[model samples]
Structures are given as C-alpha cells and as structure tokens.
Target: MKLASRIFFAYLLVSVICFSYPVSRFVRDVRMFFLESVEDALADHATLLANTVGTQMEANRFNAEDLYLAFDKTYSRPLAAQIYHFTKTGVDLRVYIADTSGKIIFDSQSRANIGADYSKWRDVYRTLDGKYGTRSTRKNPNDSTSSVLYVAAPILVHGKTAGVLTVAKPTTSINAFMEKEKPRILKLWYVSTGLAILLSFLVSLWLTHPIKRLTRYANDVRDGKRAGLPPMGRSELRDMGLALENMREALEGKKYVEQYVHTLTHEIKSPLSAIRGAAELLDEQMPAEKRSRFLSNIRTEANRIQDLVDRMLKLSELEAQKTLQNVEEVQLNSLINSVLESKGPILSCKGLRVTCEMDRDVVVQGDPFLLHQAISNIIQNSIDFSHCGGTIGISARIDEGMLLLGVEDEGPGIPDYCRDKVFDRFFSQPRPDTGKKSTGLGLNFVREVAVLHGGGIRLENLCGKGLHAVMTLPM
Candidate 1:
C-alpha cells in the first residue's frame, strides 16, 4: 500500500475506536430518557386515580359498579404524534386495584388477573410498604413484545393506607420506536465514519505529498540526471529538502576534487617518467639520428601528457553535468555522416573501407553534441583496431521505439578477460597495428554521455569477426 493510504487508514482506525463508545453511550442515554418520560406519565396517572378512589371510599361512595362503569364507558380520542420517523394513533392503558390484604379488587384489561393475590407483585408490594413502586413483567416468557411496565400508588382511608392502584402499559410501542431508531442510528454512524475516512485520506495525501517529491529528487540525483529540488510547501519538509540539496553540493564538490587529484596524479606518472628518461638520454653525445629519436620520444610523451589532461578535463565536465543542457531531435544518419566525414582522413591513411547502412528517418531525442561525441569515440576505437584494407561497418536502425547505432570493425576483438573493463577509466587495449594504447577516457566519456541522455553503450565480439559497438538511445 502507498504511504498515504496507510496513514489514512491508521488515523481512521484510531478515530473510530475513540468515538465508538461515546456515540453508543449517547444513543443509549437518549433512549432511556424517552422511556423514563413514559414511566413518569404512568406514575402520575396511578397517583391521581388512587387519590380519587381514596376520596370516594372515605365518603362511602366507592363501589364495584362505579369502577365498572368508569372503565367500560367508550371514549373516542384522536392522536397524531410523529416520533422520529414513526407515527402514533391510539392509546392503551391497563389498570388494576388490590386491597391492603393483597386480594385483587379490580382488573381493567383481564379478569384472569382479578381475584388473585397481588401482594407478592413488586408494584403493589412496594406501594403497600410506603415506597415508590414500579415493576416490569413479561406476560409470555418467550415473547419479547409481551413485556409490560407497572407503577403503583397507595389508596388512603382516613389517612390510613387501604389498597394499591397500579397503572400498567405494554412496551410494544416503545420497542417499535427503538427498532426503527436502531437502523437510523446505524446509518448515521456509517455516514459519519465514511466521511471521516475520506477526510483522513485527503489529509494524508496533503501531508505526504512533499515527501514523495523529495524521494523523486533523490532518485534523480542517484541516477546522475540533472534535476532540481521540487517545490515543497512552507513546512519542515521544505526545510529538509533545502538541507539535503546543500549537503549534496558540499559533498559532491569535495569528493570530486579529491578524485580528480588522485586520478590525475596517477595517470601523469608514466608519461612524466618517459619524458624524464628521454630528456636524460638526450644529454649524451650520440649520433644525430639517435639524439633526434630521443627528442621525438620526449615530445611524444609530452604531447601524450597534454592529451591525457585535456581528455580528463572534458570527461570531468561531462560527469559533473546532472542533466543535458541542450536537448533536440537528432537525425541518426546526419550525425553518422558528420562523424565519418571527420574521420575520413584517418580511414584513408589506414586504407580501410567504410560502409554505412541506416534508415533515412531514424531519429533520437537527446543532446546532439553529446551523441555525436559518443559516436565519434566508438568509431575512433574501431578505426584504431581495424586491419589495413579491412571494412568498418556503421548502421542505424529503429528498435522498439529506440534508435540503435552499431559500429563494427574487422580487427582482433577484445580478450574475454578484459571485456568488462573496456569502459573503465584509464583502461585501454593496445591498437592492433601499432601495439600502442591511447588514453582510456574515450569509452568512459561515451558511457557517461549515453547515461545523461537516458541511453546505453555495449561493446562485444562479433560472431566470427572483430568488435561490435552498439549505442541505444530513446526516440
């Protein structure tokens, strides 16, 4: 998974864990509040009815006929209450009375419960003991909808408790409301969680975006491509990028200077020794031809030293470049023709034949100057190794959206043991004809150019022949 996604999910998980208990508690508290309101209303009804019955009993007017008549009378009522997403219509209330002796005196809804000993019931038992009384009972053990709530109050005669009046209500309606609210609350939680996750995802992306840019910049530097620090927003991340850039500049500068000093010192030693020896030999009295040969050797060694220094400087400049300064569409055929033209004199001197085979439309996207230099180096190597009157083959073709340039020469190929080291700095194979080695910066410089242009170079022995060099670059 991406870092952004991991961060988002981690944050979301924590948020959900933190909010879950609180949200659940809040919903539970709300439901309890509504149920408490229903219980309070029921309690009030019981108290009021008990007092009226007590007053009638005190005046000797309380009787079973009045109780029956009061409960049996038809009363039409209309109710339109919208409780959340549900509606309410009619009302149903149950009432029962019991004597102080625990015998049932009246039952409004069911005669089966009348004439039964009600003293053991919580509502009547507690009210008789002069305490607030309430109970819940299920009419059927297996049926949840059969649950009912009862609240009772004391009936007094001459300030003495005589009986208990109980008001009861079934919990079916309340359960219906709760059932509807369950899914609604769940839906609300789901929506809240989804929105929270989405917000976290966006926040994660915003926070990590700068890090991603910095990572890309680091990769470019590692690949030796010319790239600049990406713009990180005004945050600590921006400060970090700046610090890295400064560090890279300091370290690369120091390291580059140190490497150049070491390599230049090492390569100049042999040429300097040769020149010194030739100069010392020239001091002796010798034949004119012999003295003149020593002078030529001294001059040749000095010139070789100069060439080595120049090549080193050029390669250093190429290596230091992080990216190409000039990028253009380069026609492969044209570049090849230019290089061949430049090398025509050498080819003529060696009596070698050159063959060019190329697609007229073959093109690549790169620094044309760098491409030309790289191709020229390869051709020069081939020319140095080619036998007199042998053929040098140059070709360019398109392969899988890339341009492939090949140079082949009929000369002794690289030995198996040293093929891998051919592109190493200051490592060169001797020329086939002269048995002399040139400064070994050419192939290395070419390799650096190929990398800068997102291309590559490979040299290998051709089948039944000499060396073949191929350079591949993007089209």
Candidate 2:
C-alpha cells in the first residue's frame, strides 16, 4: 500500500483499538453498575425499616397491619419523578419480615407467603445467623431481565436479633435504562470512530503532500523540462529535495561540459584547417590579388570561429541559469526600435522595408539585456534570410495577460523537415542571401530567454512566402 494508506490505516487501527475497549466494557458492565446503585439504596432502606420495626417491637406495639397499610398508601400515591432519561410512576420495592425461626411473617408483596419457611433463602438464612446479607434471584428462570435484588437487615429488640427485614427491588428499570442508553453510547462510539478516521485521512494527506510535490518536480526534471524545485517547508524532506537538485545540477554540468567540448572541437576544425592552408599558401609565390584574397579568407574564417565561440559561451551561460536576475519592466516598442536602428545600415544595404505595427506602450518584465539580445537575434535572422527589398513585419501586443511580440519576414520559410529542430542548439538553416548557415545558437538562446521569463517562442510559415516568429512573455 502507499505511505498515506499505511499511515491512515495504522492511525485508524490504533484509535479504534483505544476507543473500543473502554466503550465495550462500559456497555457490557452498565447493568451491573446500575444494579450496584440500586442495591446500595435498598440496603439503606432495609436497615432503616428494620430499625423502625425493632422500636415498635420493643414497645410491644409492633403490628403487621399498620406496616401493610403504610406500604399500601405509598404504592397508591401518584408519582411523576423524572430522573434524567427515566420516569418513575410508582415504586417497585417489596418488603418481607422473617421471625427468629426463619419463618416469614409480614410479606408486603403477598400475604400468602407470610407463613412460609424462608430460611433456605440466602438473605433470610444469612441475616437470621447475624450477618449482613444480599441476594439476586430471577423470578422467571428463562428471563434474566426478571431478576430482583434482595438486601436484608436484622430487627433488634433489647440488643438481640429478632427477625430479618428484607427489601427487594426488580432490575427492570435498570434494564430499561441500559436498553435506552446502549444505542446512544453506540452512536457516540460510531461518531467518534468516524471523526477519528476522517482525522487520520487528513493527517495522512497533509504528511504526504510535500512528498507528492517533490516527486512531481523530480519527474519533470527527469523528462528534461525546466521545472523549478517545489517548496517543502523547513523539514528533512526539503533538505532532501535541495540535495537532489544539487546532485542533478552536478551530473548535468558534467554532461554539459563534455558535450560542449566535443561540439566546439568539431565546429572549429574547418576554420582551423582554412587558417592552416592560408598560412601555408603565404609561403608560396602568388599574385598580390590572390595573396590578399587568401589573407582575407584567413581573417574571415578566424572571425567566424570567434563569433561561434562568443555565441556558444553566451548560450551556455543562459542555459545554466534556473531563474532571471536584473529583472525590470521593458518597453517593447522602444527596444524593438533600438534594434532596428542598430541594424539600419544592414537593412538599407539589403533594401528591406521594416514595418512596426504595435502599441507604443507595450511592456513586459524580464532581464532587459537578455530580452534585447533575444529580439536582436530574431530580427537578425529575418534580415539574413529576407529577399532584397522585402518587408519585415514587427508587432507587439498584450493578449490574455501575455506580451506577444511577433516578427514576420518576407523570406523563405522553414522547411517541413527542419521545423522541429529549429530551436535546437547548433541547428540552423542557410540564409537565402549568403547561402551560409549561422552559428545556430541564436534561436536556442532566444528560447532559453523566453523560458526564463516564464514564456515561450514559436515559429510558423507565413502563407506561401515568409516566416513568422512570435515570442510570448508574461505581461
């Protein structure tokens, strides 16, 4: 099972076990507790009644008829006693007296039992032998609820035991109370258990929430997405997440260095070979014009290598950054205007008519230097590929809380086969004018910049003749 499930079940099991025992015990022993209370009350009543009978006997005025009349009056009186959830309309007490010989005399419940031998009963037998006594007996053998408790006290005349006065109360009311309370107790148990389970589930989710976020972040990183580390609070898990991030950076840095070295070696080989051949040719006899051409070729190849190295270094710096620094609000119109002015000479030489179609106040938050470079690179690509005297469209607008800056050039659009690889490092298409490919890091750098600004870049073919590039950034 999952960690949350395991934790939930473990918590629930403990809670249920802890709650079950006491509740179950209380439910089981509730009748006994009630019976004990009733027995104590009956004992007091028996003792008091026995003392009253002893006083009357000492005065030689003890009469069974007087006692019977008093009990009859008590039984007939109307009562409406409300005790918590129980109601009492009449008393369910029975009283009987046995002589010194252990034969019954006054029997409140039935006069027919007055002359019966009660010596065999525990209450009578034990009380007649000068002992405190009590007994519980079921009136119906098959019905446990029909049980009655009897408590006996001795009647004393002149400090001598005379007879046993016994008070009996049926447990039907205690049974009634238990029957009424069992369901309520069970309900409380159920509610408590349900709340415990709910609490357990919430706790499990709370405990595992950070782990889930971290897991998702790890997965995104594994899939090579630019996913940031999730917040994990000040716990061991946060430390672990940071550790994982550090480890990933370390491993990726190693691979990055190795890949860059290999690519740089391969890219510089052509320029190095050209420079070597040109240097070798300088030692041979040749026409001045041819010699000058060879020297220019050597300079051009060296400049190409330098440009490639510079772009690669800048792209490497961009790729290493997880977040942006030097962020500020940049006016897109002014920035684009600046780039166009810087490329004025080239635009004039190529006879490209540049059209700026955007609001003057469009702004976005990002690293200004990086955004400037990204825009310049994109426009440069357009300038490189556009047919002479073709139009270059530049537009910027806010749409759906994003700043969409588009550049459309009347140049040959991207080929279907190269569409997916356009933004890849060192991937480039040949310029229509020069029929020469660039360092190929410009678009990739633009992509990194867009991503760092929490945005993206995309290029599409504009109808039948041009390429449209759109860079979207959060406004």
Instruction: Please tell me which predicted candidate would have the highest lDDT against the true structure.
Output: 2
Estimate candidate 1's alpha-carbon lDDT, on a 0 to 1 scale: 0.87
Clashing pairs in 2: none
Overall lDDT per candidate, in order of appearance: 0.87, 0.92
Listed in order, each prediction's TM-score against the native is 0.77, 0.86
Per-residue lDDT of model 2, residues 47-139, tens digit only: 999999999999999999998998899888899999899998997799999998889999887899978998999998899888878999999
Model 1 lDDT, residue 377, Cα: 96
Q: Tell how far residue 60 is off in model 2, in angstroms.
A: 3.5
Best prediction by TM-score: 2
Candidate 1 clashes between residue pairs 3 or more apart in a chain or in different chains: 226-322, 226-323
